[model samples]
Target: MGFILLALGLVLIAEGLVYALAPSLVEHLLEMLRALSEAQRRNAGLAALALGLILVWLAFRFGV
Candidate 1:
C-alpha cells in the first residue's frame, strides 16, 4: 500500500512537471493525440502499460 502511494505520488509529480514546464506543449500533444485513431491510442496506452510493468518488475527483481 505504501509503495502504491509512492508510485502514485511520483507519477503525479512527473505529470505536474510536464504541465508546469510546457503548458503549450501539453496542448499540442493533446491535439496530436486527438488526431490519432482510437486504436492507435489504445495501442499507445498498452505499450506504456507494458513498459511500466517491465520497469516495476526490474526494480523488484534487482532490489529497488
Candidate 2:
C-alpha cells in the first residue's frame, strides 16, 4: 500500500541521514551490536519492533 511504501522510504531516509552525518557513530554502533549475544539482539529487535508499532498506531490514531 501507499502508506507502507512511504514508511519504508522514510526509514531509508532516516537511516541514510544517520550514516551520512555520523559514519563513525554508525560503525561503532554496529560493532557494539555485533558484540551482543543472540538473545540480547533478538530482545532489542523485539523492543524496537514494539516501539515502532506503538508509534505508528498512535500516529494513525491521532491523525498526525
Candidate 3:
C-alpha cells in the first residue's frame, strides 16, 4: 500500500512537471489522442498497461 501511494505520487509529480514545462505540448498530445479511433486508443492503452506491468515486474525481480 505504501509503495502504491508512492508510485501514484511520483506519477502525479511527473505529470505536473510535464504540464508546467510544456503546457502546449500536453495540449497537442491531448488533441492527438482525441483524434485517435476507439480501437486505436484501446490498443495504445493496452500497450501502456503491458509496458508498465513489465517495468514493475522487472524492478521487483531485480531488486531495483
Measured against the true structure, the TM-scores of the candidates, in listed sequence, are 0.97, 0.95, 0.94
lDDT of 2 by residue, 17-42 (tens): 99999999999999999999999999
| Residue-level error in angstroms, candidate 3, position 31 | 0.9
Best by lDDT: 1
RMSD to truth, every model: 0.5, 0.8, 0.8
* lDDT (10s digit) by residue, model 1, range 1-64: 9999999999999999999999999999999999999999999999999999999999999998
The lDDT for every candidate, in the order shown, is 0.99, 0.98, 0.96
Task: Say which candidate scores most in TM-score.
Answer: 1
**lDDT assessment of candidate 2:** 0.98
Candidate 3, which segments miss by more than 4 Å at Cα? none
* Count of steric clashes across candidates, in order: 0, 0, 0
Clashing pairs in 3: none
